[model samples]
Target chain A: MYRSKPWRIFQLSGFGSPEEEGERIRFLLEHGETGFIMEHDRNTGDHLYNVDHPEVMARREDVGLTGATIQSVRDYETVLKGIPIESTYGHPGGGVVQHGPYALACYWTVARRRGIDLGKLPGTGQSDFFLTYLGCVTKQQVPTQTGLRFNADIIEFCAEHMPHWVPVSIAGYNGADTGLNAYQELGAVFANAVEYLDEIQRRGNISIVDAAKGVGGVSFRVGMDLFEDVAKLRAGRKMWAELLAKRYNINDDKAQRLRIHSLTAGSMMMYPQPLNNLVRGTIMALAGVLGGTQSLGVSGYDEALSIPSEHAHQMSLRIQQILQNETNLCAVADPMGGSYFIETLTAQVEEKAWEFFDEIEAHGGFLNTLDSGWLHQVAHKNQFEEQASIDDGSKIIVGLNAFADDVTPFDIDGFKSSSSEWKHALERLNRVKSERSAKLAAEKMRDLEAACRTDTNIMPAMMEAMDAEVTMGEIGDVFRNVFGDWQTPISV
Target chain B: MSALGKKILLAKTGLDGHWRGVSLVEKRLQEAGFLVVMIGMATPDEIVSAAVEQDVDLVGLNVGGHIEVVHKTVDQLNERMVGVPVFAGGAIAPWAKKELEDRHIEVYPPGSSLEDIVDAAFRLCRINVKASTLKIEAQINPKYSADGAKP
Candidate 1:
């Protein structure tokens, strides 16, 4: 009697102001979405800085374009103000690696303030290495080793307290979009997982079972590789089970179970005839479901134009909803599990992923490659070659390269003219700086700086900073002093 | 040669560091006898500052992020570089292609050939060209990028 839960209808809903963010989240949940993801502004969240910082102040308007400007746990309180945190499966934004601890700690602090037990809270934190290192390379971030320590600390913290929480999820979506094909995405994710598991093992504090649970939930991108991407997801589950059982010798099936979240490839949404992207979105969502993903987010039909328009966001949710309600996709597990082409691709994706895993290991594992920019180069090489193919007439993208004539009169100018939210974010950022307790915040930051210098777990100190209402820019300053900027191995 | 009179500045406006677009374009431009000054991800201010400091002949921007950022760079450059023309490319969609062209700034979206881009580079710098059969076809009708394809 397996009543399969319909794939968690999730979307990365946010941007600009806290109220606007709340409105959007409520909109998604009201419409049909079962889960919510708070996306913090990249300028602030990714850099762990507030808008008052010089780099941010230089381009103040760019702040909310990426996400809402959440300066404190108080802001998280505003965003999740009336929402039932206990019932909702939430993803509180910490998309960048360095920002992970602060993002999660802030969310946890808010939940704790409500007297909600940390042990019972259900949500996930994303301090994705691939997103940090590959996708949206931040202007400033901690070194790979430091990022690893931060992630490891989160894993340990969650395992002990927030049992239902997924501490850190590595997003293969970033790597795939950067140029890793199907198998490479899987191999790199597992390789990155070992970095955390191995670090925790060396510490000898937590059970491997607990560590596996914290790291087991991972995300990958599904693209037009259709069968291949679907196969990638199925392969992801079996590979995760195998890796944990074989490498860590974990005996619990609960620990070995791999929970997958798939974000339809943002790069796949072509800019021309943007409506064609709706079909692309539908196909990608179908692939995600076929791959047995526990959760899915469809890239907007207008993804190439700008951040998803309100209509585009609704269409993405509608596409997923249609698949869930009309297609009867939820009745089976690994729906395409045993088909010949799927099986072969699954095996190939799994096998090639292992080869890629070995390649990363040869470069001294995932974090080492990122630190040295080895993986970045591999992604770049593929990116160049693909473009070369389009240039040479070897490849053809419909709206871009062929049959581009469209009859529709509708325009997708994207979110080009929105500036009011950016202005509000700056104002709110300033207000937090003035209203927060000054002395206690400084003390907590000093402790955070000390923790960063030493190899001690930084999450607890980070949570203290949030509790004392320490701002994003203050934490960013501490990181600048401690880790300095990654020279960024990536160059075109 | 350090004093090679032909230098083109290459930069990306967004934080996205996918270098393939710039690298391929760089390779094509370099092959056509130009030195590409790769100023990887710079602000519009930085781009202008580099244009003056480097004394480059032409500017090529790989517009990966919000095209508005690229437009800002172009608008700022319009006043700064009177004779020095600018050409751009990347995940630039068709909608932006028209706006960029309206400003007399040459726009090359995903499907543009290396030949076309190189030719545009020559045109921007006022260089001589053969204007052969293939070049004519490319200028008249460019090929499209394959679905879900990236460079």
Candidate 2:
């Protein structure tokens, strides 16, 4: 008797002050979301800068628009207030490579302070290469090599400490959204997996089984191409299993099992027909479920206009709930399995993905392709082609290009978060700096710097820094002074 | 001045580094025979200074932030480079779009066609030929070379 676990409705939730982010997470959870993702302010979080950083200060208005401005453990505590971290499966920001340690350490430190066992904490860390190096390249980040080291260290740390925690999740959603086609997304994702697993194997600290398991929980973007995306996901799992068994020589079924988190494409949410996105989200999400995704996050209807409003977030969760309850989707395992058309498409996607994987290998490796801008070029080519197709009318978006009529009922002035986000975040940063033990914070920062310089796992020092109440900018300064900026390959 | 040699200064007026929108616009403008100068993620000061220094015929702002940032950039451009047309594209909400449009800034939100953007560029720059039709002419004519088209 096979019992299917209903796919977890994990929504990416954050914005404004820490308290506001907490409130949004709580709202989603109340609305039947199984897991919550903490989104840090892209200005501060993605670049690891504080609100006061000059680059951030230039566009201070954009600070909390994308996510919450979390600078210290106090902010983390504020965001996690009343949220049960012990039971909840959380994704604590750090989608960028350099920010991963700080995000994980802050979340882990929060759990520790709450008397929650670190080993028992169930959550995931996202130091996604595609996000950091490829998709949304930050102004300042450590080089790809350093990022690889950070991921490997994270893997080892999670293996030693938090067994239930997914140390690093490779997100192909970033790549696909940036422009990689379905097969390219699959290939690059597996190539990314190899970078982590191989680095862990070379380090020889943790077993290959643990490393494989750590890297297996990956995410992909399920777009409007329903059957194609479904095929891509199926191919992803098969390729993962084959890579693990053949190359790594690992036979542990638990390690070989690929867990997928499918996110609906935010890029596909057209601004003209904003309400139509709910339908798009449904179709994309259905593709995810059919592809056997373990978890799913539906993009909001207002995604193209702004960050999701409260109603938009609710609608996203309700879409998943209806699919889970009304559709009886969980009654059968691999609902699209055994179909001749689906099977052939899956095989073709797999074949193409391996070819792309080999191409990555030919270009040195995944890290090198990022370092050399090869992957960015590939994504850019597809991005331009896709845009061209849309431009020439070869591709027709419903209300955007064809059937250009607005019959929608309401006017959505995209959810504007608290305009005072920067002010509040600055005030908190000053408070934390003034109140925290200066000597202790400095000591911990030095240790973090040293950890970055040496082969030591940076997580311990990062945890101490979080405990000592170090700010994001201070850590960013240390990284800049130590690792230097990754000469961004693409001009984006 | 011919459309072929018109210099367009493109700058992202936010710290957000997602460059697909700007890059696509840049590609279209370049292919339309405009000299596209990209100052990636610049402040108002940097944008104005670059626009003046590059002697760009038109200024394109990739507005990914609050309308205030774009307003600031436009204000600076107006003060520094008089009569230079400004247009933008990105996640400009409806209200922001209206505000920019009110200030004579053409706002192309997501789903706006590249051909339309190129056409707007030509019209704003006061070029006689339509950009969509000028591509083949610019390509075939030896006198329409990027450097030769320069004033």
Q: Write the per-residue lDDT of candidate 2 for residues A83-120, one digit (tens) a residue.
A: 99999999998999999999999999999999999999
Error of 1 at A107 (Å): 1.4
Error of 2 at A64 (Å): 0.6
Q: Which has the greatest lDDT?
A: 2
Clashing pairs in 2: none
Q: Estimate each model's TM-score.
A: 0.91, 0.96
Specify the poorest-scoring 10-residue window by lDDT in model 1 chain A.
A414-423
Interface RMSD of the predictions, in order shown? 9.1, 6.8
Candidate 1 lDDT by residue in tens digits, A1-492: 014578898999887787778888888898899999998776667777676666565455466765788888878989997899898999998888877887888999998899999999998999999988776676678888778888888999888888999999889998998888888889999999999999999988898889999999999998987898888988898899999888988869888889889999887888778889999999988888888888999988877666776788899899998998887677777677678988998888899999999988987788878777677667765776676577566788886777878987977776552545556766776777688778888899999999988978788899899899988777878888998877676552
How far off is residue B50 in model 1, in Å? 0.9
The TM-score measured for candidate 2 stands at: 0.96
Instruction: Let me know the DockQ for model 1.
Output: 0.21
- For model 2 the local lDDT of residue A463 reads 93
Fraction of native contacts under 8 Å reproduced by each candidate: 0.17, 0.46
